[model samples]
Target: MENILIPLMDNELSPRFDLAPEVLIISITRETSAMGTLSERVINFETPSAEAMYRLVMAENIQTIICAGMEKEVYEFLKRKGIKVLDNVCGPVDPILEAYLAGHLSSGQNYF
Candidate 1:
């Protein structure tokens, strides 16, 4: 099982990681099929804060993060903590999540 987090803005991938208003977390079991067995959760932030997001990532045990843009420092921080950060991803959240589950998503991928 893998826990993935995606920051969101208006139903699409956020333009910048630290500025996102909300996030979607999906816990996926890859043992099933391409779609896998997914359990999802959405978290809305009262205020956008990188610290808050980082705390949530740790608390939720997030294994991967799919984001549009991220600062180098933040990227390095997550990497050092053993998290996979797929940066520069663009498009609607649903399709992006589907591509990830289907094993076709990667950093710098754009659907729009």
Candidate 2:
């Protein structure tokens, strides 16, 4: 299974990374043909810095993260950790997640 995390704000993608407090955590099997059997949970935390968020993700063994914006340095830091960080994604969280599971989400997508 691949663990995914999406920073959220009132059910939409958070306007910015640092501002996101509640993150929707999802676990989907590696076979990403469709929305696989998903198990989801919520984790509320401040700061999106690689230093802090890194620990949380590591703890959960997260494989991917879909978020709005992030510092280039932090992005690189996570990438180096072997975690896929999809940045510059904007839209309501549900549609975003659906599109992602459907295998079409990419950086700089604005489904607003």
Candidate 3:
């Protein structure tokens, strides 16, 4: 399975309480040794539109999305397209994803 993990600026990854300026979209390919790879770098150019973000994810062939927060419309669209969405995950991406794969991450309160 391939999954994307984004690190937020607060809650664990950093002391600041704001989403990272740039969203890091990672593609994790589960294989013999759990290969973690970076597919692309998505830079939100002054509040990018939901459609643009969605398109970027599609272009990178991401199956799952992990982020701090997302608009409801975008989330719904991704869900309809068969993409799993995980929200309220604030911390360093790699460790958070590792926790998720190990079944230690849980869906927290909804913020969108």
User: Which candidate has the top score in lDDT?
Assistant: 1
In candidate 2, what residue range of length 10 has the lowest lDDT sum?
29-38
Collision pairs in model 2: none
**Per-residue lDDT over 44-89 for candidate 1, one digit per residue giving the tens place of the 0 to 100 score:** 9999989999999999999999999999999999999999999999
Best by TM-score: 1
After superposition, candidate 2 runs with Cα above 4 Å error: 30-35, 46-50
User: Ranking by lDDT, best first?
Assistant: 1, 2, 3
Total clashing residue pairs per candidate?
0, 0, 0
List the candidate 1 regions with Cα displacement exceeding 4 Å.
Answer: 31-35
Q: What tens digits encode model 3's per-residue C-alpha lDDT throughout 4-99?
A: 635344323322212344456655555567554535454443554555566667776777767767667767887898987776666565677667
Give candidate 1's TM-score: 0.93
Tens-place lDDT digits, model 2, residues 1-112:
8899888888988867656778889998755554357889988876554555667788999899899988788788789999998899998988899888888999999988
Error of 1 at 77 (Å): 0.5
For every candidate in turn, the CA RMSD to the true structure comes to: 1.4, 2.3, 5.2
Which residue pairs does candidate 1 place in steric collision?
A: none
